[model samples]
Target: MNGGGSCSLGSVLCVITGASRGLGKSLAWELCSRVMPGSTLLLVARTEKALQVLAEELTLKYPGITATWVAADLGTGDGVRRTVQAAHEMNGQDTAQRVIIVNNAGSLGDINKYFVDFTDPQEVDKYFSFNVSSALCLTSSLLKVFQGRPGLQRLVVNVTSLAALQPFKSWTLYCAGKAAREMMFRVLAEEEKDLRVLSYSPGPLDNDMQEEVRTHTKDPDIRQQFLIMKESGKLIDCHVSARKMLDVIQADTYNSGDHVDFYD
Candidate 1:
């Protein structure tokens, strides 16, 4: 685990999308304890109730760290604006020397439909708006706000998937979106030499999303695969994957923008 369990990410302004549940929620838990006292946690997600609960719990547990929650759908332009504005609000904390933007807001996107059903442009656009476009815009804007300080460090993490590299029969939109976001972060890493970027595939997490895949995926083979993973207790725990991601960040060994899978 390296020093992930003990090391500090310094006083950080950490922004995590999809912070309401699953891996994002777990990441918030792990990061809140690891960052320095004055660190700020800006948690963003579509559900205000969930975000509020998470924010309150974290702040109450870690009184020294400020936890701010912004409830917005990252798919819309206004949602991205609201989130970036919140980041700007937190930027006054000059004590924060590191900024970690975890871009984890994305959807499964019609797992019941195969590629042949993906004929509607609006449907495709909607999927990309949330999965690909929003991430690119949010990450870029946040990076600018967190950038320019000579000593400040920035890490952008894309919660990507095996579908980004491999094809799933019923997950046409999802696979395309993941691939697009992964490439986007890779390009960003190349353009900004100082920033750290990672595309982490957390494996088949035993969560709601996995349950959806198991029950609704159009392809019987793929659906059966997910079912087998769940039944056999082979799916990775969200917290386990989250901790490993933090460990990887603390280790800082992987080349920037590289894709690191849970198994890897």
Candidate 2:
């Protein structure tokens, strides 16, 4: 088992997507705090301002570690290419011991509309762009980089939701997107020999996304159910969940083709 603070200087490179806020941000911060001081972290987000702020904060707090912020929309192939370029640039010409890629960026479309009522093709496309295509493209690009590099532990954690297991009625498109992303990682894990790909459902959380679900839900019963879940301590804090994910990455406990659920 890899204990805490196992990495040495400049040995680990972690690329976290959707890192501007919520679980992504929490994960980045946790990693910055726990990992070796001089490790490199590549933060990807759509918001430049947030990413810059986070980069500055990490740099200020942990002066030894290098934090590079890449503002890219991972929903498209071009964005994935840019991310790959940034990762290679960060890695420089030296070979890294470990490359941890966290696919944490996702979107839950307008939850108020039912499957039949939500007929906007654009919205459906957007869902696929952010939730499924982004994860797939990013993983593929990174895996290509990891190939032929021996003695390097590559960890890909696909951040999914419990909805992928238990489908929600109003969130048909969102659930479908998550399910597709999860399956992509699963299949990739089966084919890939070097990298460890894990489809992880981080369970529910007391985060902005949950707040959005609560606010957008028109049904009182649904809202109340979420409220109860939130109040019952079932929802894990973002920081705690992020730390658990980091532990899993460092320990390398998962099989190549594993769907690990935080709740389970």
TM-score, one value per model: 0.98, 0.91
Q: Which ten residues in a row have the lowest lDDT in candidate 2?
A: 1-10
How would you encode candidate 1's per-residue C-alpha lDDT over 202-232 as one tens digit per residue? 9889888888898899999999988898999
Q: Candidate 2, residue 79: CA error in Å?
A: 2.8
Candidate 2 on 1-264: residue-level lDDT in tens? 324463432367889999999999988888877666558889998899999999999999888778998889877777788899998788673445777888998888778877888777998888788788778878778777655476777788889877776778678877888888888888888787777887777778889999987788655777788889887877779887777776666566678757777654
Q: Go through the candidates in order and give each one's C-alpha lDDT.
A: 0.90, 0.79
Backbone clashes in model 2, listed as residue pairs: none
- In terms of TM-score, the best-performing candidate is 1
